[model samples]
Target chain A: MDMLEQYLPFFTKLTPQQQAVLSQNTTRHTAKKGEIVHNGSLDCIGILILVRGQFRVFTLSEEGREITLYRLWERDICLLSASCMLNSIQFDVSVEAKKETEYWKIPASVYRKVMQQAAPMANYTGELLAARFSDVMWLMDQILYKRMDSRLAAFLLEESQLEGGRELKMTHEAIARHLGSAREVVTRMLKYFQSEGLVALSRGSVTISDETGLRKLAEESLR
Target chain B: MDMLEQYLPFFTKLTPQQQAVLSQNTTRHTAKKGEIVHNGSLDCIGILILVRGQFRVFTLSEEGREITLYRLWERDICLLSASCMLNSIQFDVSVEAKKETEYWKIPASVYRKVMQQAAPMANYTGELLAARFSDVMWLMDQILYKRMDSRLAAFLLEESQLEGGRELKMTHEAIARHLGSAREVVTRMLKYFQSEGLVALSRGSVTISDETGLRKLAEESLR
Candidate 1:
C-alpha cells in the first residue's frame, strides 16, 4: 500500500484534491533506536503515524524521574505530541524511538485543515484522543490501587508477551523508569523475585523462570 | 443568550439545518446533588455540557475505592460519558452531580453526525478530548511522583478555594475516596496535620488554621 493508503484509510474518504494536498504536505521520516524524536514540545512539530518499529511516549518530573504513559507502534496515530496545535490540550510529553522507527510526519497545519474538511478524519481523531485518555485512566487505577509487586509482575509478563520471549533484555533502571519508581526499589523487588525462583536476573537482563508464578503474583490482590 | 448561543458558539458555525438537528436532538437536564447521573455504559448516553452547578467525574476500583479524574463545572463538555458511541474510546467513568446541577444533553448519535459534518464542532471536540487527556496525565504525575502529604494538602487547598471557605465540610472517608486511599490512611494524615498546627478537625469538617504552614508543606519536594 502507498503511504496515505497504509497509514490513514480515511485518505480514501477525502476528495482527490484533498488527497493531493495531504500527499504534498506529509514527509516520511526514520530514526534510530534511543533517538529523542520529540524533546517535550509544547508546540508540536508534527503529528506522527508510526509505520513500523516502536516509540515510547513519557512524562518527566522536576527531579528527572520518567514514567512511560504509553507506547506507539505500527499504524498508531499520535495527537498528544502536538499540544499547541490542539487547543485545550496542554501536554508536556516527550517521545523517543524505542526501536528503529519509521513514521509519517503530518504538519499540524495540514492535519488540522484536513480534519476540518473531512468528517471521517475528524471522527477518527476523536476516537484516537478518547482511546489515549482511557489509557491514562487505566494507569492511574494501577498506580493508585494496585501493589508494586503485582504491578511489576504485570509489567514483566507484558514485556515478555511484547517481545515473545522468556528473556527480557532490559536493565532494572529501565524498568524503574517505565514504572515511575526508584532504581533501588526495583532492584530490591527483582532480588525478591529471584529468591522466589520466579525470575533469574543476570547483568542487564531478566529471564522468566516461572511464568505461572509470575502470573499468580501479578493477579495477587493487595490492599 | 439562548442555549446554543450561550453554551456553544460552534452552533453558529453550523448551517441552519445542522442547528435545527442539534436543537431537535438535545434535551435540557437538571439533577439534584448526589445523583448518580452516568453509570458508565460501554454505550454512551449523550454529550453533556454543564450549564450550572458542579459535577464530579471519577473512576472506581474493583475494591470500590474511587479517585477523581476531573470535575466538570459550568460550560464544561463531557465527552467521556459517551464512550461507546465514539469509536475506539472505551471509558468506564461514572459522573455525579457534586451540587444541584443543570446541563444540556446532546444525543450521542446527533452529536456524532454533527461532528462529522461541522469542522468547527470537530475541532472543538478534539480540543475537549485533548484537554481531558492532559488532566489525566497530570493526575498520573501526582499519584506516582508526589508524596501523600503534599497531595492531600494540595487537595485541601483546592477544595477551600472551590468552596470559598477555610473550613471544608467533608469527612475523612470523603477525602480518602477522592485520593483513592483507605479512610484510616486519611485519618492518620489528618491527625498528623492537626498535630503540626496545619489544620483543626471538628466533628465533620477540617478548618485550615495555618494556611501558610500547609502551603509550605505542600510545596516541600520529596526525594
Candidate 2:
C-alpha cells in the first residue's frame, strides 16, 4: 500500500476521485530530530500522518514544564490537533520530531470539500472522531482511577508494544514526566523492577526482560 | 429566536431546501425529571437538542460507579454519544433528564441524508463535533492537571452557573463521586470552604456565598 493507503483510516472514507484529490494535494515534509513540525500558532487542518520515524506531542505549562501527552510513530495521525483546524484556532500543542521524520500535511479545506462530496469521507471522519473520543475517555479513566506506579507501568507496556521490542529510547526522567510523577519515584520503581529481573535499565534506556512479570505487577497494582 | 435558531451557526450556511428538510424530518420528545432518554443498549443518531430543562450525560463503570461526564442544558446538544448510532455499538454513555427536558432526536439516516443534501446540516455536524472535541480536551486537562479540591471547586462553580443560581441541588456524596474522590474529602473541603465564607452547606444542597472566593481558591489550587 502507498502512504495515503496507510493513513487512510485516520480520515473519512473517500471515493477514488476524492482520494486522488487528497493524494495530489497532500505535501510531504521532512524534519530532523528535535525539529518542530507544527508549532502552537500554525492555523492548518487535515491530518498529520507520520510516514516515517517518531514524534512527540506535548504542551508546556505556565511554569515551562513540558507535559508529554502522546508519542506518535509511523502510520499514526495527530487527530487531536488536526480536528482543531475546522475551527481556525491556532494549534494548542506542538509536534516535534523525536527522530528524523517524514509526514504528509494535508489541507483542511481540501479535506472538507472532498468530504462534502463523498459519503465514504463523512463515514471515515465519523469513525475517526469516535475512536479519538474513546481514546480521550480512556485517558481520563487512567488519570482518575490509576495510581502513579500503575500509570507508569502501563506507559512502559504501551511504549514496548509500540516499539515492537524490549528496548525503549526513553529516560527515567522522561517517563516520570509523562506519568506526571517525580523522577525519584520512577527511579525507585525501575530499581524494583530491575531487582525482580523484570527490566534492565541503563543510563538512557530500558529493556523489559519479563513481560509477564511486568503485566502481573500492573494488574496487582490496579487491584 | 427559536430554540433551533440557537443552532443556526451550524446550519446557517446551508441552502434553504436543506433547512426545510431538516426542520421537517426531525422528531422531538420530552423527558420528565430522572427519566432515561437513551440507555446503554439504545442505538439512535442525529443531534440531541436540549430544548428545555437539563440532562446529565454519564456512564456507569464496571464497579457500579456513576461517572457524570457532562451536563447538557438548553441550547446544548449531546454530540459525543451520537457515535453509538454511527458505529452500531452499544451506547458508551447514557443520557438522563436532570429535570423535565425536551429534545430533538434526529435519526442517523435522516442526518446523513440531510448532510448529503443540505450544506447547513453538514456544517452543523462538523462544527458541533469540533466543539465536542474541545470540551473533551478541556475535561481531560482538568482530570490530568487539576487536583481534587480544584476539580470540586470548578465543578461547584460550573453547577452553579448551569442552574443559574447561587444554590445547587446536588448532595455532597454526588459531588464527591463526580470528582472521583471520597465523600469524606468532599465533606472536609466543604467545611474548609464554609470557614472561608465561600459556601454554605445543608442536608442535600450547597449555596455559594462567595463565588469570587471559590474561584480564587480553585485558581490557586490549580497552580
Candidate 3:
C-alpha cells in the first residue's frame, strides 16, 4: 500500500477495498539503462509507474532511424505500453530504460479492472493520454514548420533544460536519434553553433557558451 | 433516446435514467463543408459524435501551413475538442467540417458527469483517445521516415480508397495542406508522376492511371 502511494498520489482517491486490490496486484521491478522494457506488440507490458530514473518511448523506422515520442520520468505513467488494456490501438512503438530505472507495474487486467471501477483513476488516465497527444502534436508542428538549424537549437535548449544544466554530455548520434535527423546533420548544426560562438562542442558533449544567442537562434526562423 | 442511440451505440450501456438525461442534454446540429466546428481555446466545445459526413482535425503552423492529424466519420467522437473535460490538454488544433456534417454535441459538464458515473462510457472514451493517439503516431512516422513523393503517392492511394474512386478532385493546394508540404512541391511531384505515367493531372483534379506503378514508386526509396 505504501509502495503504491509512493508512485501514485491518486491511490488515496480509491476506496479502501480498491486500494487493497491494487496493492496486492502491483509488482515493483527495476530495469538497467538501455534495457528494452517492452518491444513492439508486447501486449502485457502493463501500466508502469516510474518511481525513479528515466524511460524513453520511441519508434524505429524501416531505415533504422529512431524518433522519440516522449520520455517518462519519476512518477509518470506508461499508459501507451499498456496496449492490452486499450482496444483497437495497435502500433509498433517501443519503451526503453534511458537510465537505470525502478517502477511499479500494474498488470493490464488489474489496471483495467481498477480503471473500470474507479472514476478518479479513469479521469487521470484520460488526462494523461490527452497530455501525451498534445506533446505529439507539438512535435509534429516542429518537424513540419521549423528549419533544421532552428530545430537543433531548440532541441539543445530543451535538452539542457531537461538535464538542469548548460552542458549536455550526449553524442551527436544520440541527439540525432532524438531529433529524427542524421548524425551528420546534427554534427553540422553543432559546428555552425560553435562557429557563431553560441555553443562549444567536443567529441561527445555540447556546452552552451552564449545561452541568449542559442535561445534567439532557436526562436528565429532560419528559412 | 433514439437520436442518442443513432450517434452512440454506447448509449445502450447506460441506465435508462442516464440515457434520458443524456438524450435531453445533447444537441444535434449540422454544419456545412469548410465550417469550423471548434477553434482553438474554445474550451466548452464538448464531446461531438459525428452522425453523418466527415470532420477533419488538424493543426496549423505559424507559417500558415496546415497538417492533418486525422479525420472523423460516422460514430467517431471529437474528444480533443472537449478541452474542458481533459485537464491540461490545451493546444491549438482545430476541427472543421470536411463535408456537410451532422453531429451530436454533449455539453462538457454533462459528459464529464455521465463518464464519472458510468464505467463503460469512461472505458469507451479511453479507447477512443488511444485510437486517436495511435493515428498521430502513424502520421509522425510518415513525416519522419518517408520521402515526399512516396508519402504523396501513399496519401493519394489512401484518399482514393477513402472516396471509393480512382479520381480525386482536390486542388494541389489542398493536397499540400494535408501533406504539410508547399503547393509548389506537390505540383512538381504530380508532374513527375505524370511523366512517369502513374497519374494524369488536370486543374483541381488528379486521376490515378496506373495504381500499381504508383504503389511501386511509393515503395521505392528514391533519395
**Interface RMSD, per-candidate values to 1 decimal:** 2.2, 3.9, 2.6
Which residue pairs in candidate 2 have backbone atoms (N, alpha carbon, C) closer than 3 angstroms, thus clashing? Answer: A12-A124, A12-A125, A13-A120, A13-A121, A13-A124, B14-B120
* Ten-residue region with minimum lDDT total, candidate 2 chain A: A82-91
Query: Candidate 2 residues A99-155, lDDT tens each?
Result: 899888778777778766665555556555555556555445544554444666678
lDDT per residue (tens digit) for residues B1-223 in model 3? 5677766756898999889888888888999999999886754688898889999998876667778989998888898788778775757678999889999899988998888887778777888888988998888878767888889998999999998999999999999999977888899999999998999998889999999988886777434
Computed on alpha carbons, the lDDT of every model, listed in order, comes to 0.83, 0.69, 0.83
Please state the Cα-based DockQ of model 1 relative to the true two-chain complex. 0.66
Mind giving the per-residue lDDT tens digits that candidate 1 earns over B12-94?
A: 88898899999888898998999988876634788998999998998876667788989999998888787766676655889
lDDT per residue, candidate 3, A11-74, as tens digits? 8989999999899988889999999997877556789999899888877787987667778889
Model 1 stretches astray by more than 4 angstroms: A148-223, B221-223
- Top candidate on DockQ is 1
User: What C-alpha lDDT, on a 0 to 100 scale, does residue A8 get in candidate 2?
Assistant: 77
Query: Chain B of model 1: TM-score?
Result: 0.94
- TM-score rank order: 1, 3, 2
